[model samples]
Target: MNHNEIGIEALNQGEIEKAAEAFTKAIEESPKDPVPYINFANLLSSINEYERALNFFQKAIELDDTAAAAYYGAGNVYTLKEDFMKAKDFFEKALKTGMENSDLFYMLGHTLMKLEQPKLAMPYLQRAIELNEDDNEARFQFGMCLANEHLLQEAVNIFTEVVKRDPQHADAFYNLGVAYAYLENKDEALEMLGKAVEVQPDHLLALHAQKLIQEAK
Candidate 1:
């Protein structure tokens, strides 16, 4: 089989080192093969070598300017760097290249939230949920984002859905309690917070939330 094809095989097997080696060989054989560069960048990212991964992604894009994986890699690098604005830009570029990825939209939403542009983030976050209704993390994060923006009722709704989906998700119950308190629904807050403590007694944030409620009364 061709070197690129071999690399793809190694990639699917999760033999990261082998895949990288094979992809490197493929690149040496075809210096303009953006596929190998993109695949290699993904491996580098899994290893937490963000800077080097960015270089590989750039190489992929240099060979094929419209490469979506290249921009996606750059976006991930920016995410690791906590440079949310740059991450947002690269993710948008990746989307422009027709990469209709739910995770990409979720990342974009998160980045916008980090930038304190929740208005822009909401639609993307919602779209991510639409794409994958079972994404509890996305739903939870979107709820917190909305709560931070004073959309307490909506945030409560989302967090409630999270707990319903996974009752063992203590954080969801805890955060839902917090949102309930914000809405002055003290009884519901206490009920959910008590459930959170039952699920994870050592949850420090939930403990703090309880303390605040006690102090409030």
Candidate 2:
């Protein structure tokens, strides 16, 4: 196989040194090719070499402006570094390249959420869930966006689905309890809060909510 293929195989097999070596050779052999740069950047990111990874991603982007993977990789590195503004920029650039994937949408949405732009985050998170219905984390985040917008009923529906899909999701139950309480359904709120605590005995929010509701009654 070619060096790039070999590098990818090594990366998948958890052979970091071999992968790095193969990717370096690939870059040496095809200096103008963006693919090798993107692959190497991904490897560097996996190993927490954030600055080096960003350099490689930038090289790939310079070689090919339409290199969506390079943009996405840089976005991920920025996110890991907690540089949400840069992450948001790179992720949006990836989208502008016509990349439509659950992960890309999810990351962009999550970055917007980190920036406290939940209204802007909602559509991307919704698209992420639509693209991959089994992604409960994306669904949960979408629910959070809805709740942040004060669309509590919509948030409740989304959280309910999350708990149905993953019964051990303590946060979903807790959110459901909070939503029900806001909607003035006292008994249901208490029951959902109790379930949250049952699923995760140390869920402090759920415990606190339960105490408040009981004392109010």
How does candidate 2 fare on TM-score?
Answer: 0.98
Candidate 1 lDDT, tens digit per residue, 23-51?
A: 88988888978988887888788778998
Index of the highest-lDDT prediction:
2
Candidate 2: where are CA atoms >4 Å away?
Answer: none
Measured over all alpha carbons after superposition, the RMSD of each candidate to the real structure, in angstroms, is: 1.9, 0.8
User: Can you write out model 2's per-residue Cα lDDT over 93-185, one digit (the tens) per residue?
Assistant: 999999999999999999999999999999999999999999999999999999989899999999999999999999999999999999999
Prediction-by-prediction clash tally: 0, 0
Measured on C-alpha atoms, candidate 1 has an lDDT of 0.87
Best by TM-score: 2
lDDT for 93 (candidate 2): 98
Question: TM-score for model 1?
Answer: 0.91
